[model samples]
Target: MYQKKLVGVFGDPVDDNPSVVIEQVAFDYMKLPMEYLTIQVKKGDLQAAIEGLRAMNFTGINITMPHKIDVLQYLDYVADDAKIMGAVNTIYVKDGKLYGENTDGKGFMRNLRNGNVPTKGKNVVLLGAGGVARAISVELANAGVKHITVVNVIKEEGERLVELLNSKTSVEATFVFWDHKYSVPDKTDIVVNATPIGFVNKEEKPNIVYESIHPQMVVCDVIPNNMNTLFLEEAKKIGCKTFHGMQMLVNQGAIAFELWTGLEAPVQVMLEALAKVYGD
Candidate 1:
């Protein structure tokens, strides 16, 4: 007995996207006239899907994976941060114009703040130079991080990310070869895994060394499919504060929610919903 407002996530292989459940739970808790879905849009069909969302008066939609970069071409306006990262994960239509923004970095920062992890004047050892790494590194630099050492299997990509972070921001950044062993430098305050290493298969082992993690640092992984990534488990074993992958997933969705409805997102509620789905 209410009006219907449409919102959803767009990506290939989106059938298991947890955003669908968490977002719908928030909408229901707030009693908002909204429904969330996981729309599977193949790479070739991205443009048509975006156009359809706008033409049909959809509120806003979250972009993911292969579409994050391609979807930027269709937006009428892109936020400065999103343009800087060369990716867009959230899109909202307002005044007949579609606007794009990247909430992944901000979402990760919010997760850190919620967990009481400090960023200013800290050293970070980041794994991977992909999209999630780019977003997080940009945000960390903006947050006054002292220095960052990025490790990646691809030397070119890693150097590119370091150059971008060093040239564009105040953070001193460097690239290191990732041998998939315990090579983390001393005095590092944060460690992040932004790669897809752990998502390949259940039998696949973690790329980062468990013994190298110090108890004084914070370890984070961007893979959300598995809540207890081996990296996190290793960090916990060492008594280091660990941030789960789902934290960023839920926080990013909450940021998108705030952008769409202009309402304070119930972050804890969203976290609970995610835990229910992933069985935390």
Candidate 2:
């Protein structure tokens, strides 16, 4: 029997996340003598928290929220993907060195490919200008997407994302100011909700008009819980294919688990864990 190893997620507001609960389910399913825990990290204490994680000898830590970008400066090394995305959502310490990686973009790609959603030469409309949006933009552009249009209530943020993408890849990317009252472009092949608009208790749901979404369009939301987000529901009503963020979460977690343990992640076990926590 293998001795139990420890792993977990760190962030404020984590107590309410289904991901934290699902970690427990993973432990039970694997029966590999592993334990998982969630830590509530206060603002401005990310470095200290990371140092404490090292001291505790945690196998790995999942970064979240404001800490993702902030923690980058503290890492000894970062993967190229995380560097390009400007964020880190997973960290692991090895040989007295802290390494960072951003699994969000690759995880999203995995979900997209696994679900058979086409991306090559497709026109994608991405909602929001935050870290998740940044990751998705880089990944899609690199995957040979024909065009990407980003929309955000904050014009400056949207423009900034477009500039970053243009500098990184030769893909045609543009930014547009979003007026919540209007419908999104009908020419879009994929619509992604990367903002928190559809999160639990978030006041405004995604503002895209459902009537404009065609049956051939693919709609995806980065919000995991409540799989039937208003954005997804509206898209579904229009006969559009839809995806929740749960697959992204699982794929990212699997990568992090592999980094921490150097063992192939039991993906089925992780999926079972998520199903137990969120219900299939």
Candidate 3:
């Protein structure tokens, strides 16, 4: 019998609640001798946790919020996408080298395409200008998205993302104010909720009125805890196509699993895992 390799996600709040999708992928689908674990590490203790992983010969680790960018400094090498996004969501040890990669962008794009949500020549409104948002903007641009409008609570953060996208791709990117009382653009092809508005404990939701969303437009919220967020629920009521953050998590987790194991990811296994955990 092969020795079971160990992989898991690491973050402050994630220790006790590792992603169910990840666990399902490892235990049910991949069928590899691997056990998924979650490690909670506060900002100050991140370095110690990473060191401990290295010492314990962990095959790979997924870095989540509050640690994604901070973990980069300790990595041996970072992939271009992670460096550009200033975030590292996935890390793997191979041939005595630590490699970092950001699959959030690819994962988002995969979910969009899989759902038949148009992107090419579409005007996209991206909420939040943080790490995940940055990656999503880049991917949209690369996928031939016609234009992108970014909105964030902080004006400067949104502007920075716009500048980065403009410098990196020809896609027209702009920043807009997220007015709580205003309506979303009717011409917007897609609206992506990339903020932590619907995250666990952070129950604050986006202010966009669901009735303003048109059937021609698609709404995507990057919160995975619940398959149907208030954002998605409202979009559904408006007859608009919708996507949850679960797809992003699954695609990215699968990509990370492949990177670590060099085997095709058991997508069905991962999907079932996520469904069981999140009640999808």
Candidate 4:
């Protein structure tokens, strides 16, 4: 019998991330001799964790929050997409060389497309300027989003991402200050919350003006833990189409699975696994 391939995800406190169950479902469905695990490795020990993966001949490992950007320091090389996003969420080793890539953006796009949500020539208002926002913006630009308005509380990070998007992709990118008066543009086709506010704090209000959301618009929140986030709930109440955060997590995990195995991802199976875990 062939030995099992070893793969895992690493984060500061990875116990709660759904990638653990999602990837394991994929492996079992394919009947592949693979073991997927969740490892809790804080930022301080990132280098050691990565080194240990290399030493143990790990097939690949996924990097999560806090470590996504910092883990880049220990990689042998990073893909261009990951470089543009300024983070790495997937890493694979070959010939003793560690290669890093970011599939978060691609996964988001896949999820959107799979759900019949359109991106090409669409005006997107992306909330937050963090890692996930960076990935989403770049991928949207590459996928031919007509224009993008990025809103964030931090001026520096928002402007920095806009600059990167403008310089690297053909999409027209602009930064908007996120404040109390902020409202989703009426012409906007998609609104995305890449921030963590709604999930962590249930009482936290939705970032965009709930009244401004239209029936034609699609609202997405990248908070995986709570699928029916306040943002999505308000969007639904306002007749706007909504997407759950778990879809992003599953799609990204599927992309990582494919990257590691070089086989088509069992997307539906992964989705079922996510629904089972999240109870949606």
Q: Best candidate, TM-score-wise?
A: 1
RMSD of 2: 2.6
lDDT of 2 by residue, 1-280 (tens): 5556777777776556665655556556666666777777886788798888778777788888878888889989998768888889888889978999988888788889989988889999999999889998898988889999999999999999999888878679898898665576878899999998766563457776668888889998887655677788888888988988877778777777778777776777776667666643
Model 3 agreement with the true structure over 35-146: per-residue lDDT tens digits: 8777777899988988877778889888888899999998899987678778898899987778889899988888988887777899998989988899989888888999
183-253 in candidate 4: lDDT tens per residue? Answer: 88889999998888867677675556688889999988888877788788888988988888788888898
Model 1: per-residue Cα lDDT over 1-280, one tens digit each: 5558899888866556788877888899999999987888889999999999877779999998888998889999998778878899999888878999998898889889988888999999998999999999999999999999999988899999999998888999999887757477768999998888667564454566567677898888888767787777778889988887787988998899998899988888998888877744
Ranking by TM-score: 1, 4, 2, 3
Off by over 4 Å in 4: 1-3, 42-45
- Displacement of the residue 267 alpha carbon in candidate 4, Å: 2.3
Query: Cα lDDT of all candidates, in order?
Result: 0.86, 0.81, 0.81, 0.86
TM-score, one value per model: 0.92, 0.88, 0.87, 0.90
Pairs of colliding residues, candidate 2: none
Give the CA lDDT, 0 to 100, for residue 276 in model 4.
78
Please report how far candidate 4 places residue 140 from its true position, in Å: 0.5
Candidate order (lDDT): 4, 1, 3, 2
The parts of candidate 1 lying over 4 Å away from their true place are 1-3, 200-205
| Model 2 spans > 4 angstroms off | 1-3, 202-204
